[model samples]
Target: MANKYQRILLKLSGEALLGEQGHGIDADILDQYAEEIKAVQAEGIEVCVVIGGGNIFRGVKGATAGMDRVQGDYMGMLATMINSMALQDALERKNVHTRLMSAIRMEEIAEPYIRRRAIRHLEKGRVVMFGAGTGNPYFTTDTAASLRAIEIEADVILKGTRVDGIYDSDPEKNKDAVKFDTITGDEVLNKRLNVMDLTAFTLCRDNKTPIIVFNMNIKGNLKKVVCENQSIGSTVVWDQ
Candidate 1:
C-alpha cells in the first residue's frame, strides 16, 4: 500500500499519556499508542515523535506559582525526557526499533540531538523520539517539534491531540463550537485558536509545512490519515 506521506513528525502531548488519570503515565495508553504506531510503521511510513511535558510540569505555570522560571523550564525539559523514555520503552517492548534523542545532552540516558543522525535513523526505519524541548528556557515542546520536523524535512506535523480537530472555541466547554476540516495559518493566528505556539506555527508557515491536528486516542486514525488518506482531522497549512 502507498502512503500519503513518506515521513511524518508526530507530536504528542504529555497529558495524553495520562489517559483518564490525573497525572503520571498510564500503561494502557502507552501500550495502545505503541500498537498504533507499530501499525503505521508496518505500512512502510517513517515516523518521528516529539512529546510535551505538560502532564508533568509547565515552566510558565511554575513561574506563575513563584518558582525560578529557568529552573522550572529545565525541570519541564526533564519531564519530556521521562515521557520520551517511557514511550521508547513501550515501543521497544512491541519490537519496534526506536531511538530517544534529547536536546539537553544527557548521554547517559539519550543520545544528544544530531540532525543527520536522526534523519539516518528514520531512513533505517527506526522511530526517533526527540525530548527536552529546544534545550532552552521559554521555548515550548511545540517549537521543538516544529524545529525537528523541519530539520528532518517531514511531510507534515501530525499533532495528536485529544480533540478531533481544531475548533473555533473550546469544544469541551462550548457545545456549539465549530470544527474546521481545513484552516490557514493566518486564520489560526488572527483568531488565536491556539492550535500551536506562535513560534511553531510561524515556522511551519514560513517553511510551507502542513500540520494535521487529529484525535490520536482513536485506534486506527493514524493509519487512516497516512495510509488511506482519510480526513480524520483539521489540516492547518499555508494560506497560499
Candidate 2:
C-alpha cells in the first residue's frame, strides 16, 4: 500500500473503548485497540492520539448534582488521564513504543504538554497519547485533537468513529439518512453535518487539514487511511 501521510493524529472517543459492557475500562477491548494501532504503526505511519474520557468519567454528570460546571470539567480532565494510562499500558504490552503526555501537567506520571517533545517522540515512532482536554475546562477532546493535529503538523486527522462515514442525518435514528462516501469540508459545514463539534470543524477548515472518518472497530481501517491506496472510509477535504 502507498503511504499518504507521514504522520497522523487519531481521535478516539471514550465510548469506542467501552466495548460491549457500556461501562468502565474493558481489558479485551483495549487490547483490540492496541493491536489495531500496532498494525497501523507497522505500516510506517507515525500516530498521535487523543482519547476522550466520557466512558470512564464525564464531569458533566455532576452538573445536574449542582456541581460547578468548571469544577466538573476539571474532573473530566482527570478522567482522561485514566484512559491515557490504560492506553499506554496496552500499547506497551503490544511492544509498541508509546508516550503519555498530559495537558494538565502530572509531572510524575507523564510529560507535560510540549509540542516539540511530542514531535520528537513521534519522530522516534512512539505513539503519543495526549491526555487532558486542551488544559482548559470548556474545550472538548474533538477540539484538542484538531489543535494537536495542527501543532504536530500532521498530514491528516483520522477520526476513528463507530460509524463508517458521515451521514446526512443520524443513521441509527433515521433509517433514511444517506451515507456519504466522500464530501468536502465546506459542504460539511454548510450542510451542518455535525460529524464533529462546530469549533473542531472550523479549526480543521481554517487549517486546511483533511479529515477521514471511519469505523475503527473493523480491523486494519486505520492502516488503510494512512496509506495512499484505496481507503475504507470517507475522506473530507476542502472543495477546490
Candidate 3:
C-alpha cells in the first residue's frame, strides 16, 4: 500500500489498556490493540509504540504523597516494564512481529534502547515497543515518545488518546468544544495547548517532528494515521 509516512512513533495512554473498565489492563482491550497494530502492519508502515504506565503506577502520585521523587519514578519505570511485557505477549499472539526494548535494561525479557538496533528493527519491518519513560525521573512518557521519534527519525508521533481529536477547550468539561483539523506547534505553545506536556511539546517543536493526536479506540485509527490516510485527529506541526 502506498503510504505518506514511512515510520511512526505511537504514544498510547496506560488508561487505554483499561478499555472500558476505567482500570488495569483488560484482556478484551489487549486483543483489540493487537488487532489494530496488525492492521497497521498490513499497511506496510514501520510502527514504534510507547505505552504509559499510569494504569499500573504513577510516580508523581507517590511523590505528591511525600515519597522520594526518584524512588517513585523508578517504581513507575518498572510499571512500564509490566505493561510492555503484556503488550509484547498480546501482539505476538496475533502473529505480528514485535520487540520490547526498554530504556532501563532488562536483557532477559527485552533489549535495551539502542538507537541503531531500533532503527534496524524498523528497517526489518518489526514493530518496536519502547518502555521505561526515557529511563529518567521528572519526565513524562510524552517526552520519551518525542525522543524516540527523533532518534528513529520518525515522520510523526501519533498520540493515541481517549478523544477523537484536539479541542479549543477541554472537551470533557465543556459541552461545546471546537476540534482543530490541523494546528501548528508554535500555536500550541502560544495557546498553551495541553495536547502534551510542555517538555514534550518543546522537543517536537524544536526538532520539527509533527504530532498527530487522535483516539485509538476509533476502529483502525492507528493504521489510518500512520499511513497518512486522513482520520479523525488533530495534527501539530510548524506553521512555517
Best-matching candidate per lDDT: 1
lDDT of 2 by residue, 66-123 (tens): 9987898888888888998999999998899999999997899999999999999999
Q: What pairs collide in candidate 2? A: 2-228, 4-228
What tens digits encode model 1's per-residue C-alpha lDDT throughout 16-55?
Answer: 9999999999999999889989999988899999999988
lDDT: worst 10-residue window of model 2:
223-232
User: Which one wins by lDDT: 1 or 3?
Assistant: 1
Q: Residue 156 of model 2: what lDDT?
A: 89
Ranking by TM-score: 1, 3, 2
- Cand. 1 TM to true fold: 0.98
lDDT of 3 by residue, 85-146 (tens): 89889989888899889999889988999999999998898999999989999998988999
- Report RMSD for candidate 3: 1.3
Q: Better model by lDDT, 1 or 2? A: 1
Clash pairs, candidate 3, are none
Ranking by lDDT: 1, 2, 3
- TM-scores of all predicted structures: 0.98, 0.95, 0.96
Candidate 2 ranges beyond 4 A from true positions: none
After superposition, the stretches of candidate 3 with alpha carbons farther than 4 Å from their true spots are: none
Q: Backbone collision count in every prediction?
A: 0, 2, 0
